[model samples]
Target: MTDPCGECGARACEELFHGLLALDHSRAEPWGPLHGVSVSCFLLQHAGRLPADGGAAARGLLQAYLDGGLPAVQRLIGRARAANSHRVKAGAAPGGAARGTAVPVGREAPRGGFTVTIEQVAQGGTFPAAGFPERVRAWAAATLEVSGPHSA
Candidate 1:
């Protein structure tokens, strides 16, 4: 059977997922090393696979990140990093394996999904605290197709 996400042709979701992975891997200069892969990315990527409530759940988490500011984003990244480490140790692909693969990343569905995390120390403290909000805003716009006041 075709994967539910593929069947639904959720290209936006897939793009967001891959984009987030690239961002996480690259440790972009402004972001100062994202702690882990975002759970938001995973949910959006597999939106079709989620239960009926998945959209709302994913939106809520994303909103929380938007509203939460730098500290909150940092905390979520921490969780993602921990989850990622666990997956790696378990011999599972860090982030959903090879797409289309049914590898569950911790929990799934309306409750929310999972992501892997990374830890690295930047020589000069994290990216400027003021810059983080803008970075996230840009990320939301570029990756999620999110625009408008909420995107910032």
Candidate 2:
């Protein structure tokens, strides 16, 4: 596996992927904060996986969570079944059309990078059972600060 991804310079992405996948996503007693919070932040930080509009898509989604928490994210993503049905009918695939393609309409993407990469997240996110949620939040917040409107 990539120690630090060549494209995004983040070392923790693969590790974070595992940690996120381990979380309980079941409708019953889910790890609520994590389910809504982690992915967008990861995408924002990773940068390379982002749509052609750049990590703007991810940053905007992260801002949604920052602005209104889980409910806001849920409102943005809405019911999964309904979203999937709509996606199928519209012939739209998940992750949008493809790489280098236009992202769905939204504000222009952030400065297109991260000040704190996933290496820090992985270093800090070890021992997932120990304060993982807070660590993720802090990492994401740091990333957002640099990716925000005044990044220079």
> Best by lDDT, which number?
2
Output the number of the TM-score-best candidate: 2
lDDT by residue for model 1 (1-152), tens: 32324422332444444554554566665443442314443444443443343334344445546667556766765665676775466655344333233323553422212221111111122324455445444443332442122221
Each candidate: what lDDT? 0.40, 0.56
Task: List TM-score per model, in order.
Answer: 0.34, 0.59
Candidate 2 per-residue lDDT, tens place, 1-152, comes to 55666544666567756665566354222344555456656655554455565555556656776677667767767644465664466655444424554433664444335555545555555534455555656666766786662221
Please give the lDDT score at residue 50 for candidate 1: 39
RMSD to the hidden true structure, all candidates: 12.0, 5.5
How well does candidate 2 score on lDDT at residue 16?
58
Question: Candidate 2 — which residues are off by over 4 angstroms?
Answer: 1-12, 24-33, 79-130, 149-152
Estimate candidate 2's alpha-carbon lDDT, on a 0 to 1 scale: 0.56
Q: What is the Cα-based lDDT of residue 60 in candidate 2?
A: 60
Candidate 1 achieves a global lDDT of 0.40
